[model samples]
Target chain A: MANIKGAVVVNKERCKGCDLCVAACPCQVLALQPTEVNDKGYHYAFMQNPDACIGCASCGLVCPDGCITVYKVKL
Target chain B: MDINEIIKPENMVYTKPRLMNDNPMHYCPGCSHGVVHKLIAEVIDEMGIEEETIGIAPVGCAVFAYNYLDIDWIEAAHGRAPAIASAVKRLNPKKMVFTYQGDGDLAAIGTAETIHACNRGENIAIIFINNGIYGMTGGQMAPTTLEGMKTSTCPYGRNVALNGYPLRIAELVERVDGTCYVTRQSVHTPASIRKAKKAIRLAFENAMAGKGTSLVEIVSTCNSGWKMSPVKANKWMEENMFAKYPMGDLKNV
Candidate 1:
């Protein structure tokens, strides 16, 4: 099974590609890239690297779409 | 593949990228200015108005809003976003025009300009972020700062006898004859954020339909000014700020 620790998971469906999450994340783990359309017909924000997440939840907090989730190791 | 599937957060990264790589933002942590910018960008993206929309960025924390929003934005004089919005819409009626301003810029210095713009029934969307205190200029007192609140300039707490009561811009703006829709909502909670997005989307739709000027005032928070952490700031906003600036649609055409 994947350890899935310190990973940032984006709902993609709820993402609005506003970049607010990117701006909020202090670790710079998030970046905007035109990829696929969500149910809203807009591009969703994605994580540049899931391993870089510090799980500060700043991305989740600032996301207007409520589409981000930051998980940390059980340590 | 499915539109519903596409609306997920992971997918929203680049469907409508424009500006944001350059320029610097001056807002502090937990400031709702960024959220407001995101909502506006979402509205533009969903409405397909990016190419034709022109934004007027006001002074205050929103001074750098143009940097984040991909559409063509013109920096307006302090509190003059509405005046510039008026001129821009008049010049190109077909184009979607909007002004993003903060309480300090709108209610304080730009009150006359904003009031007249709405009174004239200008076709535009006005996104007003009211974080109580002025986020920029080091959290100074703004016209909308609550009574008994302490700011940089009002460290002893604002005296109603001296500063008077806080100004409710959303309520005041609703009374304007030309404003079609005016609503005040908070962004501290998920439910409120969703509601704000809906209201904002409606405002844009209203303007796009040529209904008239629509304004959505988001009751935001400035953690730095309120002297609270991000989480504490959100909670404090719910407890203290909500009573002063009640949320809901004040008017709609």
Candidate 2:
């Protein structure tokens, strides 16, 4: 089976929830959630699909806050 | 820490540096300057030039760029970012230098400084934020204000017979021989934001690599000055400003 493991990680405290990263991700793996607040009192977004991540790194490239990380798992 | 396992849409960790701190920016809510600021910070972070960089803030809405960008900064006297950047770089040739300016500051009163800096080919990065109106000074008519565009100074839509057409600063600067890289991008949406960041990073990288003066003109929105919502402001820029200042690389020498 064609498969990749691992997931994307985000630093909650630094995320501004701007959604720029969400918009840049091609796999629709990032989303700005209304749930959770960072230290700065801003509602930080959470990643939804870690396994679906292709590790293209576009999220990291476009995130204004540098709060996103994508990793590929070797099974 | 499964770092990757804990990954969800909201918890993704980005590799770009968050140079912009938590300080509240002085720009109005709907101002395009905020977007431009974010774009610049993102670019600086991606280029890894934040630590050894000095940025000059102009006298318009972009004057407070220092507050948003976490880097060594110097405030210029209204539209003189190029001049200040020129001096700062000349004094410390090893450091990367940049200037953030607006239409009112760059194309209007500071025209001479901008032209000469580019003409002299000072090795500096210039982030030109063009929103067309004099945002800080109560939405006054600026040199780049579009024809038939109403501003405080031109209450009844700019008249070409009176104010002439909008000044295309990017085109004018591209004609100068000293300017090695010049590109105009917009920051109205995510896709455009990506493009803007690429352009800005390239400008910074070019200067850091000892290239000649590099300029990135960002077509931004001035919601407060334009008397429109942030979303509408983006729309207005797409409809009006884009026609006046089409996005693309003007000169990449």
Please tell me which predicted candidate would have the highest DockQ against the true structure: 2
- Kindly provide the TM-score obtained by chain B of candidate 1 when compared with the true chain B: 0.90
* CA error at residue B165 for candidate 1, angstroms: 1.0
Task: Compose the digit string of candidate 2's lDDT tens values, residues B130-244.
Answer: 8899998899999999999989989999999988889998899899999999999987665777788788888988888878999999888787788886556777788988988
Q: For residues A12-48, what per-residue lDDT tens digits would candidate 2 score against the true structure?
A: 7766665656656777777766666776766666668
Error of 2 at A34 (Å): 12
Question: Candidate 2 — what's its lDDT?
Answer: 0.78
Q: Reference contacts recovered by each candidate, as fractions? A: 0.05, 0.25
Task: Tell me the whole-model lDDT of each prediction, alpha carbons only.
Answer: 0.76, 0.78
TM-score of chain B of each: 0.90, 0.93
Q: Give a tens-digit lDDT track for model 1, residues B48-105.
A: 8778889999988788777666789999999899999889988998898888999899
lDDT of 2 at A46: 68
DockQ of 2: 0.22
The regions of model 2 sitting more than 4 angstroms off are A1-75, B1-17
Q: Categorize the docking of model 1.
A: incorrect
Among all windows of 10 consecutive residues in model 1 chain B, the one with the lowest summed lDDT is: B13-22
In the order shown, the chain A TM-scores of the predictions are 0.77, 0.79
